[model samples]
Target chain A: MNVLFQILFTISILTNGDIKVPNSGFQPGDKASDFDLKSVDGKNYSLASFKDAKGFIVVFTCNSCPFAVMYEDRIVELSKKYGKKGYQVIAINPNDPEVKPDDSYEKMKVRAKDKGFDFPYLFDDGQKVYPAYGATKTPHVFLLDKNHIVKYIGAIDDNAEDASQVEEKYLENAIAALDKGKEPVPAVTKAIGCSIKVKSK
Target chain B: MKVFTAIISLVFILSASKAQTQVLPEYDTYDSLSAAVFRNNDTTYVINFWATWCAPCVKELPYFEAFNKKYKEQKFKVVLVSLDFKRQIKSHLLPFITKNKIASEVVIMNDKKYDTWLPKVDASWSGSIPATYLVQGDKKLFAEREFANLEELEDFIFSFSKYK
Candidate 1:
């Protein structure tokens, strides 16, 4: 029975696309791979593009996701507060336009304009960057230091519904730790958000 | 004239009662929700963590509903744990549930401490919705994505529970 069960489990993993294989993306302490993707402002941005920056707050987000929408203002606030401090916020829409039309580059440009986004809201065309980073959902954040080492990988903060009631700012704290030349305490966190839409195989 | 008025009022009351009959999902803290799913029993439980705001989760909900209905007589249960914001319970969550007539046992997980509760649900979970947990006694399987169809969902449960 145990042998049969093991065989069944293995087959399920093989056949089921929903079954997540462990550790498919970057973890804390792992160096990130840089990518050049197009932003809504008609500019190409790679990690090297921000030469004067200290680190990057690469947030995987999109226009349609309510959770992402909830954090839109906060994301902007993060950029404004930390941009001068040398941390650049590079928001990426990693969802496939075919799967989610609202996440298409055109709609992204609309969202960016409407929200007055002060950061690069880039489209991960062909859906390559997110998989490489192992980002599973929109509003998923990865805070990277100047060396491109992933300092934190999770939510922007604890409260996704209302920012005024936020108790802990995970990404901000992580960035602060990196600024002070120390490791982020609780470097990894998680939050409920929309899964990164991809074309079904 | 009296008879006509009486019938019209009866219809109004009936429709009003029907509207009131829609189930409002109970709000649960993470510990209470966890306790409910981790019950020690012979029945197999498929706990799906989702929300109305999550498109993929909303799309895949019918599969769970169908599977639960199909296996109504068996030792199986489907518990839909909604991660929708507590504030939106009335505005969005309840209305969506009523509009779709989602019959699965739905409850709102009103916990915001993802760093604490997410790992408790599954160490591998990265806090994404449309995730599911199938539990029966000591055996458990966690899938972090949406099921494509009813057959796929059934296969996932059957793999662990051996339920037909």
Candidate 2:
């Protein structure tokens, strides 16, 4: 088995020339690239569009993921609570709808309407934006400072199963810290979630 | 026709009873499960991460079962680690496991903090289900994706087990 793994590893290196998937290099403190994506309201949105905003809560989420569904209320609440403070929540559906029909643009619209989302729910149509942000799962967040620099990257909170049981509100804390003119505490965290569905090769 | 119908029902009942005979799985934390699977370094571990709610994970479960049955003589072991919620264990996961008659040892991974254990399992793992880990002593190969078919799974198993 060791020999087999060694051979596969060596062959992968020899054949592919590189071992890692190229796009996942985004990290905190790095500047986030602005995206021009159509929102559920039929208007196009970009980071530059928010004139008076202090920063953005750019969340890569979808309709199909259980974790995403669980956090939908909190996401909406976050936008409502923080939007007044200049941190707008921009929810992006990064899943390829062809792979997960429930997450299709049409369904995304339905979900947003049903949940009464106050934020812009955009679709990553060609799946270009998420790979750039290094988003691996639904509910994955990238909090950006006013300069478009990433301040936090991770789960909405420490708990996804139950919001009441949540001991740490990561996103809220980050926003509060930013509001207080400080760096976010624990800028990164992990939570189990559905992987962002991509087109099969 | 009536006699034939009776025979069919009898066969169905027998198979259904057989399917229900497998033991129920116990829930384990990530640390405990990891320790259990890696307890014997001499054995090759084919640990598959899956969940009942995941369509892709269910689709590839049969391939893992087939691999386990086919190589029962070898030192190879297939441990199916389910990521299903604990509350749904009795209502969903167990019934699914029984209906499928999975041959591999099944366990529910009860860890909630994905960030802590994901890196420990595999540094490159992006917390995706339907992923697999092939562990043999010091060498470990992790694939954060689903198997296309049994052939692909078998080929992977054979590739690793050949040198042994």
Candidate 3:
């Protein structure tokens, strides 16, 4: 695996194509906007209901992404650990079913059911929510306070492929900070995962 | 099959035109061109590498298009590279690029050498989509995450251009 990563790094250096995708909407310290996304059971889940929590966690994730799937246990652990502490964890599926059918509503339901997700799996139909939150990658996490203020925005952990070796749990720290009424020091970290599939115009 | 072919044809025409105007000829292998790729040739090169199946890649493409419009006269060029499979050159690459109407230079670097190629682009890149590298006048900055808006994008460009 180290050799593979080294080779990939070399290729990136060697490839004449030296550029990255550009999107500026998702950044640290941005105020999180309220969302009225529909949950799996056809009910709307809004930020208003969780306005009283010490903090809220909005993770722009999906059912099919390996990065997201690996975090399933941790996400559940997060919800279990934080939900009782007044932090709401909501998962949003921003993929276009017309393009990627595996991310369709039904698949989301089955995956959620099969995985025993304890969080709300919401669907952003027109994709009006992710850009507001500036979510560019899957399993992209946004930690907010009770006032819907953004505390942290980035990956859930340091390691996506290997959960065991995670050195820094970014999301967990953000929640902990919010719980303690202090600002999260390292508010943004590198999130290695699949990108959110916005509808191509 | 007729609809599919029509779409494919449309995609090809669009991408080819953009490439003629903006995209440089792609370097397929990851072991080629390390220093020259970022050698400030007086042209501000914007390289956006993404795949068809990547959602974040699709999400941020419009920003590249917008950047092209905002900086066309200042020796600024946006180059979009499709990181799909080589097989997609005919079936998926052309149509996706064409239909997107991406006015920037578009090329399909359909090589599976990501493990060998992703880091060469930038050591910070975690093999993620929507990653970007901005090069201007011997200055280079790579952003592993996504940007939020045009102002931020412009700031990144201006800041890097000022580098010693």
| Top-TM-score structure, candidate number | 1
Instruction: Order candidates by lDDT, high to low.
Output: 1, 2, 3
CAPRI tier for the interface of model 3: incorrect
Tens digits of per-residue lDDT, candidate 1, B103-154, equal: 8888888888788788877778887789999887767789898899999998
TM-score of chain A of each: 0.89, 0.87, 0.84
Q: Which digits, one per residue and each the tens of the lDDT, describe model 2 over residues A1-201? A: 999999998888768522345337478889999999998888999999997899999999999887788899999898889888889899999998889999888898899999999989999989999988999878789999989999998888877777887888888898889888898988877666777887668
Docking class of predicted structure 2: acceptable
Q: Which candidate wins on DockQ?
A: 1
Q: Evaluate residue B118 in candidate 1 and report its C-alpha lDDT on the 0 to 100 scale.
A: 88
Candidate 1, residue A187: lDDT: 91
Interface RMSD of 2: 2.6
**Deviation (Å) of A150 in candidate 3:** 0.5
Which stretches of model 2 miss by more than 4 angstroms?
A1-23, B1-28, B155-164
User: For candidate 3, lDDT tens digit of each residue in A1-201?
Assistant: 999999998888677454545455645556677878888877899888665777788888887775678788888888998888888899999877786788898898998888788878999888888877767667888888877778887778766556676777778887777778788877766544686664545
lDDT of 1: 0.88
Give fnat (model 2): 0.43
TM-score of each prediction:
0.88, 0.84, 0.57
When 1 and 2 are scored with lDDT, the better candidate is 1
